[model samples]
Target: MNDFSPALYEVLYVSTLATDQPLSVVAEIAGRARIANAQLEITGLLIFDGQRFCQQLEGPKKQVLKLIERIRNDPRHTNVEVIHHGPLAGRRFQHFSLAFSTVEDEDALARMEQLDGSAALAAFENVCEELEL
Candidate 1:
């Protein structure tokens, strides 16, 4: 029996939205991401403020890497920072979604900030471990 597990890659990207870009702009970007995810079999979460976006993408390692490279080359974003990345034991998100919220939505912002933090990554690992996915 083949014991090899599928490689899972996770990346956290932070990018600035163009100044005065409309909400429709974000929607367009999210629409593109959704299409890419569907085509690539990637799953993850996208979070955005009016002017910035932070997202996590997890999937087969090679595919995720290719997707990230494409995202870097895309002109829709500037100042993209890859905050976290590595092989994940399992997927963090079961499907792709663009979850929109404002900075004024303090609780939501705080949750996303936590996910972006070092501590939460460890916690995420623990959760994945417990779930045994």
Candidate 2:
């Protein structure tokens, strides 16, 4: 019989536009992130509120942590913080390696704000629910 490894998930936080990154540049960043994540089999979603960035990554623990280390050293973003991390029964983001979305709806923004500070992971789930992606 063969054995398999369990999956782990992690959530990362970074200051939004804290580096004064323009939308075009952020798009570039997202593109790069998607590429790297795909190569490492990382799956997750990146959420933005024009104020900050919150991302959830799910995969094998070793790969997930390694990718996170690279993200911590990335100069394009600051205040890199890992807010939530642990083993997961399954990957929440199984469809995309790196999914990017923005909160443009006023009401959605309010709902997300309510999840921040003490509810970051939940906030990620909420954003996914709203986007259906």
Candidate 3:
């Protein structure tokens, strides 16, 4: 019971958003999600490089899927793409309801240059490691 099984834990996906939504709007969205996710036993990281949003949500399989559907319907998000999804042997962000990172506007634009592949994901992960968030 004390061990975490990859078969039992799930990290829904890694998604990056494209939209005209402002940073404040994104922050507000994270705030709301944080409250709700806490109740649902969800933990995740929300990384926004201003223009794009890269998030990783981990929780029970069913709840994670439902949240993904809700996110798809949210008007604030457009061109939402699930980069990767699968069960995890461990949680990348277990201490948070929704951890957030805000990238400067200039950095955001620069990140786009690297977004064509895994570089983007690596950049976000670097931020998480750097900030220990």
Candidate 4:
């Protein structure tokens, strides 16, 4: 079987950074992503802690992949990890935003981090399976 589905769909993922970067820096990166998304017809959400950032990008597969590539190559982030990636049945966010939340705040970081790696990969696959994407 092919690794990617034949249907046209969106890609979603979360990226994390180290605990040393400032919120302003993260905001700037989010802003740039927003502009880029606008130009590319993509939409998503971005959350930032004082030190790290998490984002969910949804758009055409190729566009989302290009955006992910740019984000991964960006020098501003340290520990950029993909939390989830697959076809989103619908867009969760209308526009790209830089959301700010504290790492110590409740289960924000834990929740996002929980969706990383194999767990998240499985979750995305399940979503595709259930939704028939």
TM-scores, all candidates, are: 0.70, 0.77, 0.73, 0.66
Provide the overall lDDT of each model, using Cα atoms, as 2-decimal numbers: 0.64, 0.69, 0.66, 0.58
Query: Where is model 2 poorest over a 10-residue stretch in terms of lDDT?
Result: 1-10
Candidate 1, residue 79: how far the Cα is off, in Å = 0.5
Spell out the clash pairs found in candidate 2: none
lDDT of 4 by residue, 49-93 (tens): 455556666667887888788878877776667776776666655
Model 2 TM-score (2 dp): 0.77
Clashes of 4: 0
The pairs that clash in candidate 1 are: none
Please provide, for model 1 over 63-85, each residue's C-alpha lDDT reduced to its tens digit, 9 standing for 90 to 100.
Answer: 88888888788777776777678
The alpha-carbon lDDT assigned to residue 79 of candidate 3 equals: 62
By how many angstroms RMSD does model 3 differ from the true structure? Answer: 3.9
User: Which of the two, 1 or 2, has more lDDT?
Assistant: 2
